[model samples]
Target: MLSLIVSNPLFGVVLTLGVYFAAQKLQEKTNFALLNPLLISSIFIIILLSVTNIDYDSFNKGGSFLTMLIGPATVALAIPLYKNLALLKKHYRVILVSTLSGVIAHAILIGLFTFILNLSPEMIATMIPKSVTTAIAIDISNQLGGITTLTISVVIVTGILGAALAPILNKFFKINNPIAQGLALGTSAHAVGTSKAVEMGEMEGTMSSLALIITGITTVLLAPVTQAIIHSLYF
Candidate 1:
C-alpha cells in the first residue's frame, strides 16, 4: 500500500501540502517564530523522502504544480498593496531608492564574492538573482545563462533563511519600523520572506509586497548589466 501510494505522481503534491498543513498547525499551536511552516515542512519532507528512498525527480513530478501556484500567489499580494496604497505613496521615494540600492549592493557583493572565490561566470549568474522572487529570478537566471536548477535551490534557501531570520535580526538590530522591516524582508528574501512579514503585521506585509515587486523589476532590468560587468571584471 505504501509503495503504491508513493508511486503515484500526486504523492509529491499530497505529501508536500500535507506536511506544510501539519507544520502550519504546529506553528498555530506553538506560536514559535523558528517553527516556521515552510521550514518545518521542508525538513519533514526531506526526512520522508530520505526514509522512503524516493528520488527528487519522482517527487518533483507533482511538486511542479506547486511551483505553478507561485505566480498567482504573488498576484494575490496586490490586495494588501492596494489596501495600503496611501502608505506606499507616502514612502514611495524611500521604497524606490532602498530597493534599488539593495539590488545594486547585492550584485556587487555577489560578484565580488564569486570573483574572490574564483568561481565560474555561470555560478556568478546563478547567484545574482538569489534574492528575488522565484518566478522572476528564474527568468533572469535563464537570460543570464545561469543553471536554473541551482538558481532555484539557492533562491529557496535564501528565502527560507530570510524568513526565518528577519524577526530575530530585526530584534537584534533594534529595527522596529514596519516599513523598514517589510522592505528588509522583501528586498533580501523575496516571497518567502514576505510571507513572514505578512505574519508580522498588515503594514509589514504591504511594504514587503511593495519591495518584492520593485526589487523583481529592478533585478530584471539590471541582472544582465551586472552579469556583464562581473564578466568583464573577473572573467
Candidate 2:
C-alpha cells in the first residue's frame, strides 16, 4: 500500500503541499526566521523520501508538475508590480541600475571564483545562474551546459541565506529605507528573499517584486555575454 501510494504521481504533489502547509504553520507558531517554511519543508521532504526509500525519479514524477507551475507563478508577480505602478515609476532608474549591477557582479564573481578554483566549464555554468529564480534559472543553466540539479541546489542555498540574513544584515547596517532593503533582498535572494521583504512592509514588498523581475531579465540577457567574457578572460 505504501509503495503503491508513493508510485502515484499525485503522491508527490500531495506530499509537497502537505509538508509545506505544515511547515508554514510551524513557522507561524515559532515566529523564527530560521524556521523558514520552504527550507524546513525541503529538509523534511528529503528526510521523508530517504526514510521511505523513495527514489527522486518517482517523486519527481509528480513533483515535475509543480515545477511547471513555477513559470506562471513568476509571471503572477507582475500583478503586484502593476498595483504599485507609481512607486515603481518613482524609482525606475534606481531599480534598473541596481538590478543590473547585481546581475553583472553576480556573474563576474561566480565566474572568477569558479575559474580560480579550477572548476569545469559545466560547473561554472551551473553556478552562473544561482542568483536568479528557478523558473528561468533552470533554462539558463541548461543552455550554458550546466548541471541543472547543481544549479537548483546552489540557487536554493543562495536564496535561503539571503532570506535568513536580510533582517540581521539590515539591522547591523542600519538600513531603514524600505526601497533599499527590498532592492538588496530581491536582487540577492530572488523570490525567497522577496517573501521576507513582503513581511517587512508594503514598500519593501513592492520594490522587491520589481527588483526580482528586473534581476531575472537582466540575468537572462547578460548571461551569454558574461559567459563569453569569462571564457576569454579566464581560459
Candidate 3:
C-alpha cells in the first residue's frame, strides 16, 4: 500500500503542495525570515521521504512533472517585466551593467573560492552556476561535466540563503534603489529571492524578475568561458 501510493505521480504533487502550504502558513504566523516556505517545505519533504524509506528516484517520478513547470514559471516572470516595461526602458543601462556584473562576479567568486579551497574540477564546475535557477543551472552543470545533483543542491542553498538574508543585506548596505535591490536579490538568489522582492514592492518584483531572466542568459553564455578559465588555472 505504501509503495503503491508513493508510486503514483500525484503523490509527489500532493505531497509537495501540502508541505509547502503548511510551511507558508507557518511563515505567515511567525513572520520570520528564517521560516522561509521553500526552505521549510524542502526540509519537511526530505525528512518525510527519509523516514518513509522512499528513494529520490521514486519521489522524482512525480516530482519531474513539477520540474517541467519550471520553464513556464520562468517565462511567467516576464509578466512583471512587461508590466514595468517603461521603468525597465528608463534604467536599461543600469540593469544591463548590474546583471552582467553580478553574473560574472558570481561565477568568478565561486571559482576563486573553490580553487582556494582546492576542490575538484567537477566540484568547481557545479558551484559555478549556483546562483542561476535550477533548470538553467542543471543544464550548465551537465554541459560543463559537473555533478547535476551537487549543482542543484548548491542552487537551492544559494536561493534559500539569498531569500533569507536579502532584506538584512539591503538594509545593512543602505541600498535604497528598488532596481538595485531587485537586481541584487534576483541575481544572487534566483526564484526564491524574487519572492522576497515581490513583497518589497511591485517595481522591485518586476526588476527582480527581469534580473532573473537576464542573469540566467548571462550565466549560460559565460559558463563556458568561466569553465575554460577555471580549467586553465586548476586543471
Q: What does candidate 2 score on TM? A: 0.93
lDDT of 2 by residue, 1-235 (tens): 9889988999989999999999999989998777877788989999988998999999999999999997898788678778878887988999988999899889878877866798777887898899988887998999999999889888888998999899999999999999999999999999888999999998898888889988988898988888888887777
lDDT of 1 at 211: 95
lDDT of each: 0.87, 0.88, 0.87
lDDT tens digits, residue span 62-162, model 1: 89888888678667756766877898799999999989989998998897787689879889888999999888888888898899978977888889888
Listed in order, each prediction's TM-score against the native is 0.85, 0.93, 0.91
Q: lDDT: which candidate is best?
A: 2
Q: Pick by TM-score: which candidate is best?
A: 2
Report the error of model 3 at residue 206, Å. 1.5
Q: Report the candidate with higher TM-score, 1 versus 2.
A: 2
- Would you list the rank order by TM-score, best first? 2, 3, 1
